[model samples]
Target: MFVRTATPEDWPAIWPFLHRIVAAGETYTYPRDLGEDRARDIWMLEPPSRTVVATDADGTVLGSAKMNPNHMGPGAHIASASFMVAPEHAGRGVGRALGEHVLEWARSEGYRGMQFNAVVESNTRAVALWRSLGFEVVGTVPEAFDHPAKGFVGLHIMHRYL
Candidate 1:
């Protein structure tokens, strides 16, 4: 699989899985009932910020990621990113590809570091993936995420300097 800049044309392919993941209320901080339009607005960024997709040889989108400044003004030097892999496409290295792509983008863009503000602690796969990509848990807010199956869980603040 390869990663590329995402386009509006890619949203349809992205939405179904995005909807499923957000609705599951397991990993992401997004509301379980988040609307498509809102999700689109939150995921599709512009200018200095970017969104990308990982697709197969046939151009089927397996997963996607969005990257941007961790904060505005004084904090803009730090980057932030989010990722989602279709459940059907899990365990195929899509997430790793996307993570590597985002990190490369951050480095090329001169970011000081990449920080994830709300990684659900119970999402071990994601936590592990981020760790494998060189991120460390800087902190965790206890019972910050209301998980559907795991009750209240910590929201990890993970970081990796570019």
Candidate 2:
């Protein structure tokens, strides 16, 4: 699979899985009933920030990511990102590929570091993936996330230097 910039036409394919993932309320902090329009508006970012897709050899989008500054103005040197992979494609290394691509992109763009502000602690696969990519849990807010199946869980603040 290869990663590339996403087009508006990619939304239809992205939304279904994004909706399912968010509605599950297991990991992401997004509202369980997040609508398509709002979701699209938030996910399909523009220049200075970017959204990307990981697609197969046949061009089927398997996962996506959005990346930008972790904060505005003074904090713009620190980058941040979020990712989602189609459930059917889990365990296929899609997330790792996206992580690597984002890190490279941030480095190329001269970001001082990359941070993940709200990673659900119970999402072990994701936590492990980020760790494998050199991120570390700098902090965690206890009971910050209402994980559907895991009761209240901590939200990790992960970071890594570029």
Candidate 3:
């Protein structure tokens, strides 16, 4: 698979899985019924921020990630990112590749660290992946997320110094 910076045209391919994942309400903190226009506004970030997609040899988009400053002004040295993988493409290393790519991006862009602001604690796969990639669970807000299957769950705040 190859990872590359995403263009506006990539949204057509990204929207379907993005919609499915967010609507599932099991992982992301986004509103379950989030509409396309709003999702676009959130996911398709502008420059200085970066967005990317992972694709197969045939150019089928398998996953996507967006990285940006965790806060503005004085807090801008810290970075944050979000990822989404196509359900059919899970377990194929697409998420790992995206995660690695984002880290490289953060380092190259001179970020001091990366923080994941709202990782769903029950999403063990993601939690594990982030841990394996050197992120630590700094804290978790008790019952911070309304999970569809698990009812209420914690939201993990993960961090790693670049």
Query: Tens-digit lDDT track for model 1 on 1-162?
Result: 989999999999999999999999999989899999999999989978999999999999999999999999999999999999999999999999999999999999999999999999999999999999999999999999999888999999999988
Which stretches in model 1 have alpha-carbon errors above 4 Å?
none
Q: Give the TM-score of each candidate.
A: 0.99, 0.99, 0.99
Candidate 3 residue lDDT tens string, 41-75: 99999999989999999999999999999999999
Worst 10 residues of 2 by lDDT: 146-155
Indicate the worst ten consecutive residues by lDDT in candidate 1: 44-53
RMSD of each: 0.5, 0.5, 0.5
Q: Compute the lDDT for candidate 1.
A: 0.96
In model 3, the Cα lDDT at residue 50 comes to 89
lDDT of 2 at 54: 98
lDDT of 2 at 113: 100
